[model samples]
Target: MFLPIGQVKKTGLSCHLKWFEQHEILPLYKAGQFPNALCARFIPERPDVLAVAAYDGSKIIGMAGASADTPIMWQIGIDVEKNYRGRGVGTYLVTLLKNEIINRGKLPFYGTSLSNLHSWNIAINSGFIPAWLEVETVEQENYYPCN
Candidate 1:
């Protein structure tokens, strides 16, 4: 599997969210929730927010993203299509993104649901050690973006 860094162009927020939703990984898309403008905004105008797309020639089979909120604190996220799992795409993406994070003088890390063995394994394979964890739930009626 080849992990290639995607172009850091200003992609539409909705477009990226659509990709996640299409995979059923992002069940909810609250305006202030995961991948929201706030989350993407948290990442400044720099390559700090690494967005890489796994490709089979021209088709995107998977994706991985990361950002460093602070000098030494970073967060990473990844996903692969259902039919593309177990082919090392996820692992490769994570590894490539992790290296990119480190290159920017930040620590590469990830957080996943305890029930997701695949995510856990990918994190481990990408050289991220489980250092800590926390959980939270918020009640909100306005989920997706109003626009």
Candidate 2:
């Protein structure tokens, strides 16, 4: 299949929220992880928020969602399909998201597990630095059985 042209668009709150729940949120949930990423797409509308997708036809191969917590603070999360990885899609997605964040008068912030080198590289390429780091422990109460 040909690489789909990636474009950044301003999505409506209701439509974007549904997209997030289906395309982004479910992945994390299936991984036995809670929804850590802030949902920028919601009803009632948040003017300082933006939701981006890298679509190939009607399929969303990747997504980047973020919101401005304050005039100076913004946080972003990215998700790209496995087959689409290593093809610079994540980098493109984040770069577009960062530009949108900056345009809205906020500094972009991103975080990933230390072992996620691919994600780290993308963030660095997008001009972000580690604001802070921490190790997490998953106790049984929050654990899911490994298949």
List lDDT for all candidates, in order: 0.56, 0.57
List residue ranges in candidate 2 displaced over 4 A: 1-48, 69-71, 137-147
Instruction: Provide the lowest-lDDT 10-residue window in model 2.
Output: 1-10
Kindly list the per-residue Cα lDDT of model 1 for residues 1-147, writing each as its tens digit.
112233222212221212222223322223223341114343354223455666666655667765555557666777677788887777777776677666766766676778888888877766666766677799889788767
Question: Candidate 1 — which pairs collide?
Answer: 30-143
User: Over all chains combined, what TM-score does candidate 1 have?
Assistant: 0.60
TM agreement with the true structure for every prediction: 0.60, 0.60
Flag regions of model 1 displaced more than 4 Å.
1-48, 137-147
